[model samples]
Target: MLNTALFMQQIREHPIVATISIAAGTILASEVIWKAVKFFHSQLSGKRPLRVHEVLSFNELGDICAAQHLRKSMPGSPELTKSPEPIVLQCRNMYCSLRNVGKIVEQIDRAVYSLDVAIYTFSSLILADAFKRALQRGVSVRIISDREMVFSSGSQINVLACLGVPVRMPITSKMMHNKYCVIDGVERVEEIRRLKQRKWIRPYCSVVVSGSVNWTRQGFGGNWENCILSEDKELARMFQADFTRMWKAFEKSENNLKQE
Candidate 1:
């Protein structure tokens, strides 16, 4: 005999299970209704619904009627709006990827000082390629990563090393659960984790920033990923400081390896 109340309580505690159950029930109901509708519609004109064109605002019309809008748009090159300062923030809901991150990185042809990264998981093809390009264009790149999270063991490490991107693994108690990448002297944004309430759920809601809409999904175990970007010099300087410390720690660990 099964205890119905106890089973219900267990389901309530597990949101993923509950969501799956609801989705299954809804899908089942929809299938049944569709079959019934088909059976009735077989006797009538079978066709899909027609599309509709709704009226849009001037800005919306600007998007649609491209040539006229561009013609009507102001002539002397619109004034550059003052970019608001970056803020300190945290998230577990942002999803972006290494490839997505490169859209901003590739544009940096000349870097005077340095670029530092403290990433956990990265074996991204695009990431390696972008770094190669940046290095060729003369940017001092250093990365601190987890030893265990190396994306691949063979060619990637060798190629990236040849490209002059130094990588290190941190052995601190905290599993280096950081996803933010500091770029230039400005932005520092983080990637939010992506997950389904259940395996059957479809992804529709994507978290994007007003200034950073350039993130794309690619590389590292097939799921999307993200990084926090910021423009606040103070934040960039702070992360840079943290990277320098971690780099030294990683260097010590590496020397111990060489001595061994």
Candidate 2:
């Protein structure tokens, strides 16, 4: 009532503070209105408001269904009566630590046909041994990595290469920063056809592992990272296609080097 113009001038001078204050007021008003609506609805319906635990459980179920729908709706997705369960790992909660690394190793160990990996960094010895064991089991394993990172100290790329794993790196100076692995199932085209003919569903499917976490100790233990292991055949097919394209590109680069 005393100095409206002065107050307005001050607000104009500090636009950010004014904006924050307005936003806070809006949020507070919205919360008040929402609570009022809920209260009135509860009174009319004679139903109590949901407890925190009940709300959380409902949200958890929703999340599971959402995850399933996301993978199921993709093109060429497998026909399934139930949702496919995926393993999620987060370093912030210790879900992506060394203990959980066994989960990835377990998938690798189970690979019967092929294993394809594309990663920015490769230095995890545990992962390296898992690949070795897969190779010993007669599984075809191929790796694609960043060209520069391969020469980095403590990198297991060269070691795996020496051990007979087919490794490819782009010749470009720019980093090839992708972290994914595709684990192919044992079912071949003929096997799938045979099962279809016999009216038997295929039990095994390819798996795709991807996320922000690199194949390194720091990525698994130190950094805030997340990884997802999905048993979606279509998703695995997509990753496998990308890996194939890169593998061919790297091979072309090698040919050019030979001519040069």
Most accurate candidate by lDDT: 2
Instruction: For residues 1-260, write the lDDT of model 2, one tens digit per residue.
Output: 55988878878999899889889999999999999999989855536532111000111122233344446557676633334433232122233254357568867877766788899998999899998898897777778888778778898877877777777778878898999988873333234346458555433447778888888877766666767777655566688789888988887443332132
* All candidates: CA RMSD (Å): 21.4, 21.5
TM-score of model 1 vs. true structure: 0.42
Candidate 1, run of 10 with poorest lDDT: 85-94
Residue 218 alpha-carbon offset, candidate 2, angstroms: 0.7
Best by TM-score: 2
lDDT of each: 0.45, 0.68
lDDT of 1 by residue, 22-115 (tens): 8999999999999989977863432333121111111111223334324433465332222231110111112222222333343332333345
Q: Over 4 Å off in model 1, which ranges?
A: 1-102, 107-112, 151-158, 172-174, 185-225, 255-260
